[model samples]
Target: MGRTLGVIAATIAAVTFLTGSQATAQQATSSTLTMQGYGWKLTDIVGVYAISPSETYTITFETAAMKARYAPYYTEALKQIRDAGIHIEIGGVEPVDINQCGPKNHIQVTERYRPVGTPGWSKGVPCPWQPQGLGRGGLVIYNSEYWDGSWYISKANLHNTIVHEVLHAMGLNHPNVDLDGDGTVEPYECVATSYGNKPIMCSPSGGYHTSNMGKLVHFDVSGLKALLANARAQGIS
Candidate 1:
């Protein structure tokens, strides 16, 4: 896990300033940015999505055609999240299950392709009253259509996606940066990195294509750190 984090750190350290098109999207602190439609919000993390800092949140995978094949990707993503200082753990599997999500403390990983606007999406289990409130647990659904495409998405990309969506299940949203000043957020427009951009939460187009991308970037770690800090404030830890 440390090695995975080290790779991301090195990648961020090596990122050079943007030259032409991407120059407008300068690297900004995650603490100040908000999702475009979410009203001048800071980073996408919310207090309700936080898990008990004192507990290891268990994660399970539902039986699906892709579960065995893609389980490792989700597993690696969880390790990377844990490495980022968010407490989490893997749990049991339910065979031939279909949306019996429960317990409100465990995460269920499943596969499905829901192309609403992006390739993947996640929702906290038991549902939260508002997008900003606390959520006890969640669901991570992989868009298999995006995964099986011919677009040459590397294992790094898969891992990045898993990490990104899992963070969403924990109540993180896309780190929006309206680089064009159109009063709208664009995908892959968050904090900049050497290759172009960073931030696993950068929407459909963020993160490096290199091995470094498989791990959480600096901003991602910061977001989780912020969540943990909030947990402390709420007396969850």
Candidate 2:
């Protein structure tokens, strides 16, 4: 597992895509709960303020409607992070500029409708796109189709996508593996528990379903703990 987590040291950026309801997906064979490799931010030219924020990143939504819909879901998922000793702030509705990294310790969430085939798309975390300043902020734009009923996804899947993208904004990447031993890693191919639970951070929306999708799975929390551990080692604690 240590060797697997080593990917966190070097990988520069990541992209999290939620698989559509019709997308073919497979789960890892393992039945027991496990934590796998997912890259995170260490240091970058824009300055790694993500792991070591001056204060803490405050989550802001693009509009009141977005906040009303997703903020509670975020609170549910962020509980794991806070309980693990990592902290982030939740702010109120505000206009977001996805084009540029905004204020320091800020997370701007917006909504944009992508192409029909695309599900939901979000960028890497720890401010991967920051080209300058201490702006440790990133953008997370959910696909409008999820709400417009154009894309038919379960409520669980929709909530899981929110957590997945939020984790990506915090520097976690897809812990994709060759689950089928086909010598090729595919999207949403991640380890799952015996009960059929996969990491919430899985590339194409792998996590709890039919019950509750607003909570972080053990595997996902393990990744957050790993990030904090790594940050502490880097003297960011």
Candidate 3:
């Protein structure tokens, strides 16, 4: 059975809230953070303090109820990032105003949050910060129409989406490891063996073709390592 890791609460009170002079000093002197897990090496350029303090990575939900339901899963996913040595502070979930998103590439929910055919829908768009200015750094919007119908969004898929997007923000990419020599990595594939199963990083509509919540997913360690090495080579981390 797939294991659901427990969440780790943020250690906000341990240190005096650093601001102004102290914050600047911390930024100037902070060391590069490196985490080695699942054979992948991940590094952060701005360090932990910058990412968490400003709470720059915000999640605006479609409704108050959805925010409450997804918050715990989001917390759990953030804990995984923390475990990976990437210090990230999650902002409180809030209702998203469609006007605020404008034309920015963000996750869109259709159908009502049910299967694609239902009245709700959900999708991730490329944001500006994406590599090469390519589609990246977009918003992920979820609607009730999509989540309440066929192919309901589960806690696992919601949690996995958070992890996947955060990793992207950190400059990681989907690994190029397709052990079966099939010339492609199936979505939600297991990374434990040479078989190369589906991964959450893969396109939601492609690969193993399972319900979003049912796919067993995790990071591609080697791919994460390559990202870290690249950042280090560029002196960004």
Q: Model 2: clashing residue pairs?
A: 31-194, 125-169
Error of 1 at 70 (Å): 2.8
Candidate 3 deviation (Cα RMSD): 12.2
Over the stretch 1-237, how does candidate 1's per-residue lDDT look in tens digits?
011212322332333421112122222113333322321112222223334566667666776444565556556556666876767776677542324433555666776655232434422222232222334555566666656573355566666776665666665556657878888766555666566656766766455567666566666666666556655554555
Expressed as tens digits, the lDDT of each residue in 1-237 for candidate 3 is 111101000121122321223243233432343333352322221121112211123444455565566555445545544454433454444444332332322332211333223232343322322221122123344444434454455555545654454444343433324557788755433344344444544433211223333332454434343443434443444
Best by lDDT: 2
Model 2 residue 134 CA deviation in Å:
10
Show where candidate 2 strays beyond 4 Å: 1-50, 115-126, 129-135
| Best-to-worst TM-score order | 2, 1, 3
- TM-score (all chains, Cα) for each model: 0.67, 0.73, 0.47
Candidate 1 stretches greater than 4 Å from native: 1-49, 64-67, 95-101, 115-126, 130-132, 147-155
lDDT of 2 by residue, 1-237 (tens): 011112422332333321111111112112221223542222222233224422477788878988888788887787777886666878988777554555666777777776222455434344543322122556676777778777787788877887776776665666777879999977768888788888877766678895667688877776766655544444455
Give the residue spans of candidate 3 off by over 4 A. Answer: 1-56, 60-62, 93-121, 129-137, 143-146, 152-173, 188-190, 193-232
Q: What lDDT, from 0 to 1, does candidate 2 have?
A: 0.58
How displaced is residue 227 in candidate 3, in Å? 4.9
Give me candidate 3's TM-score against the actual structure: 0.47
Give the local distance difference test score of model 3.
0.36
